[model samples]
Target chain A: MDSMMMGAMSKDMMSMPGMEMMDMSIMQACMDACSACEQACTVCSTQMMSCAPACMNCADMCNTMMRAMMRMQGMTPAAMMAMLDACIAMCQVAMDECMEHADHSEVCKMCAQACQACMDACMSMKNTMMSMS
Target chain B: MDSMMMGAMSKDMMSMPGMEMMDMSIMQACMDACSACEQACTVCSTQMMSCAPACMNCADMCNTMMRAMMRMQGMTPAAMMAMLDACIAMCQVAMDECMEHADHSEVCKMCAQACQACMDACMSMKNTMMSMS
Candidate 1:
């Protein structure tokens, strides 16, 4: 996310209970990772491999996760945790599937990496929230 | 999305284990509902209410669910079931949140209705798959 958007979001988030204390930098990293994973998965899905469905699923989950962070007004910590868990699970599945073809398909290799990064980012966000509570 | 795309997907799905036996019309309805729900949720998110985050999350999940159905090559009945459950859960959350303001906010009312329709369509698709299995 851009600094301007982050500034806007930060202002809007002031009304949410715990959100005002959130580290925008960490949230921004998570969103960036989600966006990257979504793009990578979208490309990988077009490969027509057995992993395609999983990639597509991961892409959707990542996009949702990113958007949820952007719209903090609608989030409860519980719901946010659940969503992060789901995103991480989906990313793991996609990464596992993509890894099988990583040797031959560059797209799969990149996608697997993206999934790994996204999973890590989501976990980081989860940990941050856990500590906050 | 379109007849041409559906035709292409139908042809590509022929090799998937159980998908060949699936009903395209029901799948189409589910996809359409997801697409509509995603759009409605996206618009609703801009309202900046407490429901905005839920709406954003629902939009992403619905889009993901729709794409998963499209990429049958990547889905096992198990994964599909799990995804449907997640999407349904997210939609329910979004709907419940939106319903709180339905009396005054037309956008929330419409988003809630879209979430309900999407949930129904997804359930129908699940039932159809279960019967086939």
Candidate 2:
């Protein structure tokens, strides 16, 4: 995220109850990861494999998960936890499918790595949320 | 969704664990609703209101929720519940924001209505899940 965007985000964050202490840098990293994973998964899903649906699903989940982080005030800890689990589960499914064709497809390989990274980032956020409570 | 897409979905649904009994028609309706709401929210977000971020987040969440339903095998019940909660929360945020602009913007009015309907649909799914459990 750019400085201008961060400024806009920070302005919003200040008004969110219990979110005053959030570290914007960490949130930015998570959003960037989610955006990259969504792009990778979208390109990979057009490959016409049996894994296409899973790829599509993963792409959507990553996009959603990223946006949810952006609108943190709307979230409860329970909702955040659930979203992380869904993102992880979807990423796992996508990674499994992409791995089957990883030998022949570069996109699938990149997508699998993206999914892994997204899953990790979500896990980090989930851990943070758990610890905060 | 069209018939061909529905056919593809049904074929895939059969392979998902514990999803053999899913009614495709209901699933199709939900997917269509999600897709429409995503589109509406996306357009609404471009209006540059204070609600733009929330609208954008809601749009992404609805897309993800729709896609997850399409890839049922990628989900566990816990993950599904989490996603539903996130979707509902996002929709609620978007609706509240959009309602503030509803009197002035037709797009916001439609988007708010879409958000409400999406929330209702997700709640229906959550209720179904709770009943099944």
Candidate 3:
């Protein structure tokens, strides 16, 4: 997300209870990770391997998670937590599936790494939300 | 999604456990609804209303849901159920937000209707899955 858009999103979020104190840096990192993972998974899905379906699913989930963070007005802490959990689970599944083909395909290897990073970022966001509550 | 792609996806999904009995028509309807909802929400998000964030989130979720259905090889019944639940919840939130502005904005009114249709289609899919199980 760009600085101007972030500024706009932040301003919008300021009105939401429990959202005023959010760390923009953490959210930015998570969104970046999600975007990266989504791209990686989309590329990996083109390989048509057994892992392709999982990669496609992960890509979609990551994009959704990223957008949800950007659209905080549509979410409550509970909804955010649930979405994070779902994203994490989807990433884990994608990573595991991709790892099975990692040795045979470079794309799977890179996709798995992206999924790992996204899972970690989402977990961090979840932790931040937990502490705030 | 085109017929050729659907054919390919159908062939791939035939190998999944417990998916051989799946109804393609129901899945197709759900995917179509998701795609329509995603388009509507994306357009609504650009309107810069208070509902914009929710529309963005809903758009992402709908796209994800549609892709997941297309790539059924990556999904288990449990994962699909979870995803559908999340998508439905996001759509409901988006619809609620858009409904608040429906009287003022034709875009919001259309977006709300799209969300409602998407939600109903997803619920129908869930029902079909439950019956199959």
Q: DockQ scores for all the models shown?
A: 0.37, 0.37, 0.53
Tens-digit per-residue lDDT, A1-133, candidate 1 = 8889888887878667887678778899999999999999999989899898788888877887888888766666776776787788788889999999999999999999999999999999999999888
Tens-digit per-residue lDDT, B12-77, candidate 2 = 876777666666676676777788889999999788888887778778888888878877765666
> Which portion of correct inter-chain contacts appears in model 2?
0.44
**Residue B95 of model 2: what lDDT?**
90
RMSD of each: 3.8, 3.8, 2.9
Which of the two, 2 or 3, has more DockQ?
Answer: 3
Residue B14 lDDT in model 2? Answer: 67
Candidate 2: tens digits of C-alpha lDDT, residues A1-133: 5778878988898678766766677677778888998899899988888678778888888877877887776565565676778788778888888999899999899999998988888788777666666
What are the fnat scores of the candidates, in the order listed? 0.43, 0.44, 0.57
Task: List the pairs of residues colliding in candidate 2.
Answer: A82-B82
iRMSD computed for candidate 1: 2.5
Q: Over the stretch A1-133, how does candidate 3's per-residue lDDT look in tens digits?
A: 7878887777877778997778878888999999999999999999989988898899889988987887687776766876887788889889999999999999999999999999999999999888888
Task: Give the per-residue lDDT of model 1 (tens digit) for B1-133.
Answer: 8989888888878667787788888999999999999999999989988888788888888888888788666666766776777777788889999999999999999999999999999899889889989
**How accurate locally is residue B57 in candidate 2, as Cα lDDT from 0 to 100?**
77
Which lDDT tens digits does candidate 3 get at residues B29-128? 8999999999999999999999988888888889889988887778778778878888888888899999999999999999999999999999999998
